[model samples]
Target: MLRRLVLTAAASVAALSAAPVAAHADTAADLGARAGDRLTVTVTDAGEGQDGTFDLECRPTGGSHPDPAGACATLDQVPWGKDPFAPVAPDAMCTMQYGGPATAHITGTWHGRHVDASFKRTDGCEISRWDSLVPVLPTTAGA
Candidate 1:
């Protein structure tokens, strides 16, 4: 009886430790893209624990509409201190940018984890609104 008890206890401990691994469950795979006058990105944590280092990208959808390079150039030079288009914090979980027809990628750190997401720009000049919610996984070791 004592031996059985010990074995049961050990088994319980092992199961508890592994529980966390399996606890990371997601019901569905969420992937979407949008673009309009406003560039917006929403990241949902889909891991056992809170995630971190989320990065989002805004890429011109349907293959660079016009000059992809120029669009990016405009975004890069756009002053964050100006109206509407401003530089975001180096560590913002959610972020938005203003520019032309181009996708925006935003990334940040949360709960000691790193995540990445992207969006495609298509319409608007302040009227274009790209909205999407991406799944964020836990940052693995050395990520």
Candidate 2:
């Protein structure tokens, strides 16, 4: 009887140890891009109303972005950054000029992580960054 009790106790201990702990549940759930309800993006042009606000949801792809398909495709290319645009090369030079007063804020989830990108057209670099994310951000009527 004692031997049987010891065997049962050992089996119970093994089962308990092998079972996943509660602490890792949340971590496991957030492991990666979950389908059906995993992606969303919001962009505000800082202009004013509807023209400025572009909210998007990918994974099925839908939202206010002018070109949802194109915009989502572009977003797929971004890795992560305060700004997702590639940096200017060390030797390369950017023109020194003001593009405009238009600015934009992008925040949401991409892939499986958070995304927050800021854009402005104050200077050459700013203009490039802003323009680079087109349809995601609308183009001005003229220039």
Go through the candidates in order and give the C-alpha RMSD of each one to the true structure. 17.3, 7.3
Runs of candidate 1 with Cα error greater than 4 angstroms are: 9-100, 123-143
- Candidate 2, 1-143: lDDT as tens digits: 99999999999998888676654775566553533322233443344442555667667878766678887777666765444544444575678777656666677765555666666665676677767777666664313
Best by TM-score: 2
TM-score of 1: 0.23
How would you encode candidate 1's per-residue C-alpha lDDT over 1-143 as one tens digit per residue? Answer: 99999999999999999877665532111112222112223322323332323223334422212233443344435455332232333464443443333344444321122334343332222212222121212221211
lDDT of each: 0.34, 0.61
List the candidate 2 regions with Cα displacement exceeding 4 Å: 1-50, 78-93
lDDT of 2 at 32: 38
Q: What is the TM-score of each candidate against the true structure?
A: 0.23, 0.57
What is the Cα-based lDDT of residue 130 in candidate 2?
69
Q: At residue 44, what lDDT does model 2 achieve?
A: 37
